[model samples]
Structures are given as structure tokens and as C-alpha cells.
Target chain A: MDLRQIWILYRHEVRSALRDRSIVVMSIVIPLVMYPLLLWGTFAAMNFVEGQAERLTSRIAVQDAPPAHRDWIDSLSGMGGVSVSEWMDDEASARESVARGRMDAFVRFESPPAEGAGLEQNFQLRVLYSAARDRSERARSQVEEALVLYRGAWIEGAREDLGISDPEWSGFAVVQEDLATPEEATRFLLALMVPMLTLIMVALASFYPAIDATAGERERATWETLMTVSASRGSIAAAKYLHVATFGAMGGLLNVGALVLSLRWILAPVAGPEGVGGGGLPLSTIPIIAVGTVLLGLFVAAGMLVFAIFARNFKEGQAAITPFYMVTILPAIFLQSPDIELTNRLALVPVINLVLLLRSAIGGSLALGPGLLTLASMAVTVVLAVTFAQWVMRREDVLLGSAGAGLWEFLRSHFLRRKGKA
Target chain B: MNREPVRTQALTKVFYDESRGQVRAADEVTLSCSEGEILGLLGANGAGKTTTLRMLSTVLRPSSGKAWIMGHEVRDAPEEVRANLGFYSASTALYPKITPRETLRFFATVNRYPADRVAGRVDHLIERFGLGDYADTRVEKLSSGMKQKVSIARTVAHDPPVLIFDEPTVALDVLNAIELREIIADLRGEGKAILFSTHIMSEAEKLCDRIAVIHGGRILATGTLDELRETTGLHYLEDIFVRFAGARNAGSAERENAG
Candidate 1:
């Protein structure tokens, strides 16, 4: 309850944590190197996969092809995702064969233009397939793409009046929006990372330290000295909890800062000389994120402290507290999925809210109420966790780590005797 | 007539366990210590002496008993009790990264001493404990004896009315132990009620005004060394402990309730 005590504990905990080389590496270095590498790698891999899928081909049979346009139509077979074979039988026969799953897709080419008269050149390429088949839709799309490619040259020749000769050779017209706001784009990109990273950082910062300070103390026999001090048990627990929570909050803030810096540097080259426009998220959201991150850190720390305090030793505390990481990580993983909505009910869920909020921020659809609700829920959860941990802290078995055989003998003689008779 | 610093009546603690059922870490134990007195609680590893100290310190809550420290009820006024006491033991861990000076100052600040007084108190403690040579060194770099000295300094940084030690010299060398014994006697002389737990008979005999033999979560016998010797019909305190703790009467309820 005393702010000074809490601050004192927080300061020392932060100092101790910073002194640890592993924590420093995890907090600053890993994210600095890993975030850009992972994001660039993922973007490159996705593009590669899409290009490969576009290049794949499927064989097709041609039906009812007229003589004049045979050459033009046959040229379509060379395009990607397409393979063509001539129709040997009549229309009825081909139709029957197609229905019985005899072909991937059957394309019928219409008659070509006559000589001298200049009859309109039009080709009806009908791709036939049963809808129920797995590859039918894919087969249909491939045929369509090949046809477009084959007629591309002809379409350009027709548009020669507009100086469009050799249309196939003319490259695409690039419409650059000249997006000037790297901060906005960065926010968008980070909306996903921020939520997950914040949760993870908070949980990590709070959990291990709380256990080390409390249950670890008991296991090491240091809790005895701590108890003997004139500080109240609650005060002691609070001090420890506040100290760890501050570490968690610091981690979250550092991660966010690192993410922002990385964004500015990476996007600088691509946003052209005229820097990205739109003043990122309003300044108001900064406070929200900061406060939210701090609260989450406290919640996780208090919760973890409860568990750590109850654990018999460092190893036991770890075992007790490790499952919480999953709760923190789940929100980040769910953010990766494309199909999700930020809703009021989702806000009440702990890490899930962080994910949704981050996604909304990135997508430029952030709703303030949901984020506040999420923060409130996190606060409630942490309080409950701390209270439960305190309850366990009050127990002797947890405090003394079974106390060996004397405890068993005392239980047998003292109270169990009365219980058995009843 | 009003010098008692610690008082307990039927102090007991029961722990519920999922795998092995229930455990009683401390059983109906009543005892008292006057101000300026050193009471030594002697027991084997699991004899509930630590648990009893924990209860008296307001660190562990008793299941169905009452304890008072510095005239404050441990159950109802834990904060007040904590405010008036200092406890130390071998098991008490020191923050290894912090220097002895920093650790002592941190404790002092938390106990709400004036900011100006912290430096003076810390310097006095450093000199008193003979830690001037390594006051700036992190606990990780300090010798075991030096670390013990720092722990002692940190525990008494606020100069509380009560001081408790649970095997305060368990791992130290003889010289450090001697220094600690002197400090304990000095603190008692300054009118601080001191309770300590130790297995060493000599340390108890030298320091304690009264000694209690604890076993199986209960205090079996308590008296001055001569009083215990005469009552148990044994000249040595260890023999007296063995007599009470090893007796068949101690296991009578255990035998009747065995399933």
C-alpha cells in the first residue's frame, strides 16, 4: 500500500534484472535482429509460394474445334496451368466422356474469320466440368488465364488506334500512391507484434523474478529472514510484486520502442524522398498502450508471484508458472490468422484482447472501448491471481516445503486422530 | 512486570497437501520471552522450530492459535508486529548482485528511516560487522563469513525492538561465529528481545537465557539449562532433548491412530 516501499522494491528488482546478461540480450538484442529478418523472410517466402502455384499446369482436351482458328487456339496450350489435346470424337461423344470424368477440362474453340470478307474473329472456348470435383475450380481458372494470355496480342492489335500496338510488350502502368507515412505503416505492421510482445514481456518479467524472490527464498531458507523483518507479509509480497511488474512493463515498453525504431529505419528507403505522410496514431493512444502495458505487467507479476510463493523451490515455481506463457502466447498466434474480429467479448479475454487490439490498430480500425475493457479484464485477472497466490503463501506446507517427516507425524497424532473418529 | 517481548498460546499450523493428505508443521506450542532475553529454540531439521519462529515473526499464519510480538497480536496486527521485529537465519538469502551497503540501505529505506540517517546507520553497521574491507563488493564476491555479516547487518538495519536468528552461524567460520555471538549478546544487552534457533548446544548454552527443546511441531520442555538438567534427570541438554523427544509417550497418539 505504501508507494515508497513499492518504488524501492521496483527500483532494486529492475536493477537486478538489468544486471543479468541473458535478460539484456532477450530484451534488446534478439528483437532488434530477429524482427526485421523474420518479417522480410516471411514476405519473400509468401511471394515465392504464390509464383510457384501460378506456374503449375493441368492438361486439358479440346472439343468441337473449327479449322480456321485451330492454330490460334492451339497456341493457348503453351501458357502456364494449361495443357491442350485435340478432340477426336463428335460433340455428343465428347460431352458423354466429359460427364464420366474422362478429362480435366474440355475446351471447344469456335470457327475463325473467313478470308477477304473479314468476318468477325470470335472464339467460344467452353471449359466443361462437374462442380463437385476437387480440382474443377482450379482447372477452370487455369483455362481462363491461358485464354487471356493467348488473345493478348490480338487485343493489342485491335487497340492500335490508341497507339497500343504490341500491347503484350507494353508493361503495366504503375499507380504509386506515394504513401508518405512510415509511422502509420509501421504501426500497422506492429499492431500484431505489439500485443503479443507486450503479453510475453509482461509475463516473463513478472513470473521468474516473483518466484525467485518468494518461493525461491523459502526454498533457499531466506524467507525466514524476510519474515522476521518488521515489514508486514502483505507489504513484503507487494514490494516484490511491484518490483517484478515494473520489469515486465519496462520490457513491453522497450519492445515497442525497438519495434518503432526498426520500422523507421527499414521503411526509410522505400517511402521515397518525400517521407511517409499521416501523423501515425494519435498521441492519445500512446498513453493507452503505455498504461495498458504497465497494468498487464503488474497483473502478470502479481499472478506469478502467487504461484512462485506457493512453489517449494525455484524448479517447482517454474513448473507451476510455465503454463502461463501459453496464455500469453496464444493471443499473438491468433493474430496471425486472417479471419478474426475485434469484439467486446474478445476484449475480456486476457492475451486475446492484446492480439485483437494490435490487429485493430494495424488495420486502422481501433475502437477505444474494447481496448479499455481489455485492460480492465487484465487488471481483474491479475488481482485474482495475486490473491490466490497470497492464499497459498499463507500455507505452511508451501512455505516450509513439506518440512520432512515431522509434519507427517504431527498430522497423524494431532488432528487426523479427531477426523478419523468422526 | 511487563517486559515480555514474545508470547504464544497453543500456536499450531496445518498444511493441506494434495498427494500425501495433510501436514502439521507446528503443533500446540506455548512459550514466552522477556525483553532483553535470548531464547534458543533447539530441534532437529523438521522439529517445527523454524515453523514456530515463522509464526512468531508473522510470516506464516497459525492454523488455530494465537501469538503476540511486541504486544501486537500476530494474526490481527501482523504489520505492527513486523514493524517491531527483525529476524535472521542461515536460510535468509542475500541479493547477490547488490553490495552490502546497498542491501543494508535498501532495507533501511523500506523500514522508513530518515533519508539522512540511512548513510550513517549503514556506515556504522559496516564498521560494526567488520565488513569495511568488502562493503562495496557484491555479495557474490564476498566470502561466506562476509555475506553472513551483511545478512546480519541488513536484518538489524532499522534497529527493531525484537530480533530473531534461525541458525545465524550455520555456515560461517569460527571467527565470524564469535563475532556474531558478540553482536547477539550486545543486541540483548541493548534491551532487544532475541529468539534464535540452533542445533549447536554450546551456542545455545552461551547465548540463551532460556532454552526450549522442540520436536514434532511441539515444545517438549523449556527452562534454564540447570532447571532442564534437574527436571529431566540429565546433566547434559542433549540427553534431556533425547529423553523427551524419543519417549514412547510422544508417540502414544501416533500409535493409537495408525491405520
Candidate 2:
């Protein structure tokens, strides 16, 4: 294939794409401005909802409690956002009230855990609430905390009466410490949002360009003219693929940059300064993330071109590419779950593997073996997609959108024919 | 004698349809156009005019038979064939976002015109096509006629020895059509072999040194206008086409009824 011809085609496509307003908006404007706005809007909404939830009062009902316990529960009335009411009914009735929203939650003492069971056995208090109802769930936790505080006060009084001063009577004290640095902590939070968002943005960035270069040319009737040029079909396809991949890579870089800036400047301050480190993503992991992102862009760009070329027009191309876009994005959604990791098996999958690799790289946990395997697998898939695109370009029926006979029709005419049939 | 600039030997292309079985879009069509001559392909809609031009342009491969452009086999040396031929159709379009100057430059470069000569060739095409006024304007903002001019200029930017025009004046206005006819005549004078397809009898009568009437993917008649008139004893080219196409249609109907 002639490199000069390919370069000519590539330069023309890129120049044309750059002049398009929508392409400019999607690849550059959206990453730089829309992302920060979206981040700011989401954080503002979350804060507002949390404040509203805190101000709402929760009603709790007490059932099957002794007089002494009832008095103790009554003291919770003075606490903020908690309303205590006595229920003179069976446990079933109290539970019905909580379920019906007449009460947020109900606390029941189970006969002091049976008197003869043992002194070692603690009192059994059951808090009934529906997790589906936010207020009921909140009330259950609040009541549990109140009960624990009351129990502690009672224990201290009993100890004073027995002249016991040692704190060991309660239990051994447990101390917890987090060994992660500020950067490591930020990486986890950033990994949850950045890699997935970046993958999706890169796919979006390549979508319009890929479709415009392939199906859009056909729609405008320029594809035939280009095909009649001296350039080989493979060279033309390679040039288009390269043009699309550049957009994807640009999108990835812009998104990563915007995300880091937003997190460090905008979101971190809202998250009270400890949200993300001053410097986002360790310096050591940048190379891995960058390489992984570029490879993913190449893979996505080639895949989009193959799908887009199957369409006969711009609208049909959009329809054809939407499913692929969804397929690429749906797997990246799984990246949101922190539990998913870059295992060997996951590293073999396409979009998911890239997201996982990015996640690992950001978190500084990327193993060389799995990382290299992911990159190699992505490269092989990209090569296959590009080859398929070139082959499609060479097929007249495909490029012309001519309706070719289906396999079933071919079978009916040949293999399925009866003996002596003309 | 002199090497034919474009030649096809039983160049056949068959398309298979589920309901119609094998449809012969172009069937055993043997034809040639020598340098300094214009050969007109006359056919009705779906009469394989576009298909034949497509095959010769190296845009489509023939199922059976062979086509050559300046001695380069289309199947074996498609790039070489494309390099030596300039193919244009009503469907040929320009990149909307780029100026005509850029479009010409791009085509010239891809056609492998010498890097040093590309600018000169592009400037010449702009002046030749009278595109200088709006040559730097994006194609999308240009008029339909201007776009057509740009398309034609780009096609001939490499100055190939053979030219193929498939209904090149289909959507053009009368004045632009006349201008295009003049251009084709001038190219023929320049010794480029030209194969043009059109249904307009006047176009063929005025420009073609020889005309081929194709019906149902087969060339039914091939001769100059006077030769065809004498052979059919018809006074006009339209009457001659009517007779051949009518007979072909009747023969196909008879075969279908018999089957």
C-alpha cells in the first residue's frame, strides 16, 4: 500500500472533520466544559439531598418493653430528628405500623433474653424497619445507637456500685488505622469514575468521525469516487481508521486531563479537601494509563468503522452504531463496582478488560503479566477489525449497499435443488 | 492497430436475487474505444450502463471475462488501471467541508501526481473549469453546478489517458450539460479515449463518433449514426433504439411465457 496516498486521505478526512461544528463540540468542548459542569451538578444535587434527609424527623414505636425501658426510650424524644411513641399492641401490630408508614421503625425487647439463659448472654433488642424506606432504615440505626449509649451508661452505674474501676470489665479495646496514603485514597475514588467515564467519552468521540468517514461518504456519494482513485482499498481504510483513532485518543487525553483538573480543583474542595490528592494519579502510573487508553482508543475506533460501514446512509449508520456504542459502554458500567478487578479472565474480554486495566493502573495495582496480555489482546482485535473494514471496502455489494442473496437462498438454488433441476 | 485505450472482452457481471434467480446486469459485453474517439453507450434505465462503466473503472469486479484500461488488466492490476483512467458519474460528489482547491489537491496527490507538480495541476484545473471565483469556498456552500464542475475537475486532475462518464449530465441544467459536452469533445480532441453513457439521443448524435445500443445487458447494435440509420432503414437514432429495445423486451417476454 502507498503511504503517500494513505496520508493524503488521512489529512483530508481529519481536516474536514475538524471543520465540522458538531465534531468539535463532541471531541473537545464536551470533555473540557460539560464534564466539569456534570461533576459540579451531581455533587450539588447529592449535597442537597443529604441535607434534606438530615432535617426530616423519624417516628419510632416501642413495643413489649418494660416500664424502665419505656422511660429510657422516652428520653430519645429530646434528641434531634427522632420522635418516640408508645405502642400498646402486639409485636405484629407494631411491625404492621412500621410497614404502613405510620411508624418509621419499632424497637422490641425480647423478655430480657430469658431470665435463666445466662448472665453472660446480652439482652436481645430487635429493630424492625423496611430497608426500601429510607426514613425507616435511618430510624433503625438511630434507635440502635441510642440503645447502645443507654447500655453503656447502665454498665458504668453498675460498675460504680460494685466498686469496679478497671475498663477491662467491658472488653479489650480495639484500635483501627488506615495505612493508605492520600494518593492511594484518591486513586480508589478516581478509579471509580475516571476510567469508566474516559472509556465512554472516547467511544463517543470516535462515533461521529467513524460514521462520517465511512457511511457518510457513501451517503454523500463520494465513496465511489474515492474507491476509483489509484489508492488501494486497504490504504484508504487504514487512513480512515487512523483518522478515527486519533479522535478517540484525543478524547481520552482531554477527558483524563479534564477529570484530573475537576477532581483536584472543583470536586476536592466540595469533598472537604480529602476527596482527592492535590496531584491526581501517581506519576509512575501515568505511562500505563496512557498506553492502555491509546490501545483502547485504537480498538474502539476500528470496531466503530467496521460497524459504520455496514450502513447505507448517515441515519442507518447511526442506528447501526448505537448498539455497538451501547455494547462498549454497558461493560464499562460494570467498572463502577469496586469489587470487580482485573483478573486473567477479565483481561481477555475487550472493553471490560480495558476499563479494568485502567482501573488497576490508576490504583497502582496493575500486574505486568495481565497488563501486557490485555494490551496484546486489544491489539490483535484492532488488527482483525481493521482487516474486516478493508475487506468490506473492497466488496462492491457491501460498499454499494446492494442487496445480495442470503445464505438460505443460495442453499435453495444449489444444495437444496432436486436432481435434474435446471 | 493502434493500442485501444479501453477494451472489454465478454465482460460479464451477474447479480443473484432471491426472487429473480441470476440477473445478468452486464452479459458478455465486448467493446472497445480507441484513442481520439468518443464511444457512446445508449441504454434505458437498468440496462447495465452504470454497471459496465463501474467494471471498467475498477470499482466493481466482473464475475466472468476481462476488462483492460491502457493494457492494464482490471482484475490483476486494478490500481494501474485506475491510475490511467478518469471516471466520473452523476453520483460523484465533493467533500463538503473542503474548498475546491483542496479537493483537487487531494485527488491529485492520491492519483500520485508528482509532489512538485500537484500545485500547478490544481491551479490549471481551477482555471480550466472556471472555478477561480469560488475555488477557495467550501463545497457545501457552492451551487450544484459549481460542485459538478469541481467533481469533473478533480476527476481529470491526474490527466489520465482514458475517461469514463456515466450519465454525467443526469442532474445538470441545460447550459451545464452543454458545457460538459464541450469538455468531453475537447478531451477527445486531446486524444483521450472517452466512453460516455446517456439516454439522450441528441447527446449521442452530436458527440459520439460511434454508438452502442445496449438492451438487457447485451449490446444490440454498434455503429455510427449513419451506419445504424442505413442498417435499420430508420431516419433517426431514437427510432433505431426503440426498435432494438422493443424487440429485446418482446423476446424476453416470450421466453418467460414459454417457461
Candidate 3:
């Protein structure tokens, strides 16, 4: 592309973008205002959740037990997180307690066994749980485990000839994941939000202004004068791309700034305040995450401008940028998945790579090679997109607002006609 | 051949609509205009006059034809062709925020004016176009006449060899239109080849050295007023135009009636 013409288009795009109030709000103001509020809200929510989880105590009702099952029921009442209450033969009364949410669960025992028969001949216990209870599901599972332990011991005593060692193996085996610092958890959450915000800001700042300056001008027929000059079209496109990219980059940077300033506040409950030993999250990684966020933001903005130029007018330009919004939001949704991580190959997946990289950086274990590769991949992708955009600029139909014409018509007529044989 | 400033052969621009098939905006049109002359292009609305001017100016490439502007092929050497021409039309929009001076300077830079001469070029055009008074005013706030003048200034700032104008005075008042005519005359006097499209027969009669009457993307006839008068046996240029264009439309009407 000719640098001079591109510069002219770029300058106009940037100037127009700066003048738009909506673009400015979406790109800069919204992030600046929203980040702090969101951070404060998130921290508040996390604190509330932690408190609720810790204070929870489940109340369960037990009924209809034979004398042989009495000891087992008593053992369950002894468990720390569960409060067991006895109920008479009326199952309806116990169920009412569960419905009222006064009791998390209720248990009932069957008929008594004959003398000289085993406890298996006696009775089974039934546990009824309240759906409203948050930890009622876990409490119910623990109750079942207690019953199984009793049954296993009875079966082992009955089968003395069979060689069985570990009867408690199936009851409760804890599987522990590597413990992450509170900072890591906070970074995980921010990774989802930061990339999406950056993408959105870039798109808003660049798309409309780029369209207004280029396609909009052309549709108004003013571009004829620009094109009639000695300037090459390539140069004009280059200038325009540069101008748009700068605006988009600025928006991304502003969002990054907002996030950096609000990071500690937003993640305080999860990561805690600096110098307080409860949270392992470091507030210092904010700058590192900001760099990656800003780079990704620029790429998004430039790409949006290139795509927005395909629109026939300002209104159509807005419609055309819908996919870009989806592109940004889609990756943020992926970060909510517990399995997603910052792997080497994932760094090449466009916007997701930025989020993943930022997550790893904030979490304090980013691999340098993957981070650099992600940057390189983004640069290469940007280059390819820009090249395609240059070709679109060269196309008379695209420049003239005829880019939306049916593909078959373009192929059978314009493209085929250019090939001479058609 | 005279040094033709603009020439086209079989120039056709077909606009395809999904709902409606191919609409021939400009169809199989062969034309040429020599240097240092004023060629008036006359056509009704949707008759492809603007499209023709666009192709000649290298703004819109022809769908399946060839054109040369100042000896440079528009398709192959668009930049060279663009470098050699100035173009203006009423449809041309102005940048809303920037002043006329800034817009012109920006265009001048893109047009590759020598750094030493860029300032002088902008100044000359600003003074010559009478935009000196409002050169620093944002174009969005400028009067229509003033904006028109700025558009003209922008077009002429680089002083190319050819100029194409398409109904540039469409929205202008009588006084502004006359001033624009005067400006066109002045530019022509400097020996720059000029092509202008207009529906106004009087303007074409007064300003054009030669006239090409076009209808339905096809030129029906072209000549000096005297030549057309001799051929059509009509006193006024409008009479000749009406006789030929009216006959073509009437014949099509008759065929449709018969069918």
C-alpha cells in the first residue's frame, strides 16, 4: 500500500473517531467508570459467598429406625457439619420440617429383625433432603457414606472366610487439586473480563470513524476528488489503517489503565489487600497484564476498521460490527470454564491467547516462549488482515459501496469478466 | 488523432441487483475529447453521465471496457491517470470538522506536492477560489456556495492536465452558478481539457465547445451547435436534442404499445 494516501485516510479516520461521542464513551469512559464499580461489586460478592459457605449448618431428621440401626444413626448426628434430629413414626411431620426448610434432610428406618439374624435383615434408612439448602446435597452424600460404612462392617463379619482387607476404600477418598494462591483465582476471573473489555473498546473506537472517513465519504461521492489526486490508493489505505489502528490502540490502552488502577480493589476479597497474608495474589502483575491487553486491543481495533469499511454506510457499518462483538465475548466465556489454561498452542488462537497470557502473567507462571509466539501470531494475523483490506480498497465495487452485492453476481460477472475468457 | 485528454471504447458499467437483473448504467459507449477543449456531456437522470465521469476520473473502474485519461490507461495506470486529473461533483461531501485549509493541505500532501511548494500551492488555490476568507472555518458550518468553492479549490490545488465536473452547480443559487461558470471558463482559458455533465441545455450551449447528447447510457449525437442545427434542420440546440431523444423514446413507446 502507498504510505502517503494511507496516511491521509488514516488521519481523517482518527480525527472523525475522536469527534464521535458514543465511540469515546464506549472506548474510554465506560471502562474507566465501570472497572472500579465492577471490581468493588465482585469483591463484595466474593466476600459474601465465602461467609455463607463457612456459616452453613445442615439440620436432618431421622425416623422409623429398628434398635439395631440406632447406633448408626447416632454416629451420623455426631458429624460436625450435620445436625441430626429424631422423628417418630409419622413421616408426614418430618417431611413438613424439610418443606419448611427447618431441616435440611430427614431419615426413616424400616421393620425390626428377628433374633439371631444379621443387621441386614433388620432395616434400611431413608434420607429426605430439602432442595433449598445450599450444602444439603453434600450433607446428604455424607449421610449415605455413614450408612455404607455400617453395612460394609456387617458384611465383612459375615464373610470371615473371604479375604477382604480394605472395606472403607469406597466410602470416602479425597482428591485434592494443587492449591492456587488467591491471586491466581483472582487473575482467572479477570482474564475473562479484561480481554472482552479490551476488544469491545477497540471495536467501538475504530469502526464508525473508519467507515465515516472512508466508505461514507465515498458514498457521498467526495472520495472521487481524493482518488483523482496524484496519491496512490494503497498509500491512502495505509494512512487510514494507521490512523484507525492508533485510535483503537488508544482505546485499548485506556481500558488497560482502568483495569490496572482498579485491580486491587476489584480482586481484594479473592486476592486480598497488599501485605495481608490471607491472599497470595500480587498487585504488581497489573502492569504486565496491561501490556498484553493493550496489544490485543490494537489488533481488534484495526481488524474492526477493516471490516467496518465493507459496510455501505454508517448505519450498515454498525450492523457489520456485530460479529466483532461476538468475537470478543466468545473467548471471555471460555475463561469461565474450569479446564481452560494458558498452553503453548492456545496462545495462537487470537483474542483468547491474550486473555490466557494475561491470566498466566497475573497468576505468576507465564511461559515466555508462548507469550512471544502469541504476539507474533497476532502480528502475522494483523498483517494478513491489512493486506486483504488493501485488496478490498483496490476493488472498485468495494470502494463504491457495491461490496454487498451477491457473490454469484460478482463472480459470474465482475470477477469472470476481468479474466477475459468469460 | 488529436491529443485526446479523455477517450473510452465500449465503456459499459452494469449494476447487478439481486431482485432486478443487470441494469446497464453505461452501455457500449465510445467517445473521445481532445486537449484544451470543453466537452459538455448531456443526459437525463440515470443516463450514466456521472458513471462515465467517474470512470474517466479513475474513481470507478469500468465493468468491461477500457479508458485513457491524459494518455494513461485508467485500469492499468489508475494512479498516473488520477495524478493527471481534477474532478468535482455536487455529491462530493466535505469533512465535517476540519477547516478548508487543513483539508486542502492534507489532500496536497497525499497528491505528492513537493514539500517546498506545498504551502504555495494551498495558498494559490485558496486565494484563486476566493476561499481565503473562510479557509480556516470548518467545512460543516460553511455555506453551500462556500463549500462548493472549497471543493473546487481542493480539486484544482494540484493543477492537473484534465478536469471532470458532474452537475457541480446542481444545488447552487443563480449567482453561485454564474461564479462557477466563470471559474470553469477561467480554467478552460488556461488550456486545461475539461469535461462537464449537465442537464441544463442553456449551460451546455453557452459553455461547451462541443456537445455530446446522451440518453439511456448511449450517446445519440454529438457536434457543435451549428453542425447539429445543419443535420437536424433545427434552429435551437434544444430542438435538435428533443427531436432525436424524443424520437428514440417514442419509438420504444410505440413498440411497447404494439406488443
- Best lDDT among the predictions, by candidate number: 2
Query: What docking grade does candidate 1 earn?
Result: acceptable
Return the TM-scores of chain A for each candidate in numbered order. Answer: 0.59, 0.75, 0.62
Q: Which window of ten consecutive residues has the lowest lDDT sum in model 2 chain A?
A: A403-412
Model 3, range B1-259, lDDT digits (tens) per residue? 4388888888888886667878888887788877778899987787789988888877877888899887788889988887778888876666777889988887677666666888999998898888878988888889988888888888877777788889977888999999999899898898888998998889999999998888878888888888888889998877887898898799879999999
Q: TM-score of each model's B chain?
A: 0.91, 0.96, 0.92
Off by over 4 Å in 3: A32-192, A218-225, A262-291, A302-307, A368-373, A405-422, B1-3, B14-24, B63-65, B247-259
Task: Select the stronger candidate by TM-score from 1 and 2.
Answer: 2
Worst 10 residues of 1 chain A by lDDT: A272-281
Model 2: CA > 4 A from native: A43-170, A268-274, A335-337, A403-422, B1-3, B250-259
List TM-score per model, in order: 0.71, 0.81, 0.71
Per-residue alpha-carbon lDDT of candidate 3 for residues A212-235, written as tens digits (9 for 90 to 100): 656576656566555666767777
Model 2: colliding residue pairs: none
Model 2: per-residue Cα lDDT over A1-422, one tens digit each: 88888888899899999998988888778877766898899988998999998899999887666766654686577668998877788888887988899899988767454674574434577889999898899998888888778878878877888898777574777788999877788888877877888888899899999889877998898888888999888788889999999999888888888877777788777775665665677777777778877887888888788677767688878887888899999978856888888888888888788889888888778898888888888878777877766776566666676622322332344445634365
lDDT of 3 at A404: 65
- Winning candidate number (TM-score): 2
Please report, as a residue range, the 10-residue window in candidate 3 chain A with the lowest summed lDDT: A274-283
Question: What fraction of correct interface contacts does each candidate retain?
Answer: 0.71, 0.82, 0.69
lDDT of 1 at B22: 72
Candidate 2 RMSD to the real structure: 5.4
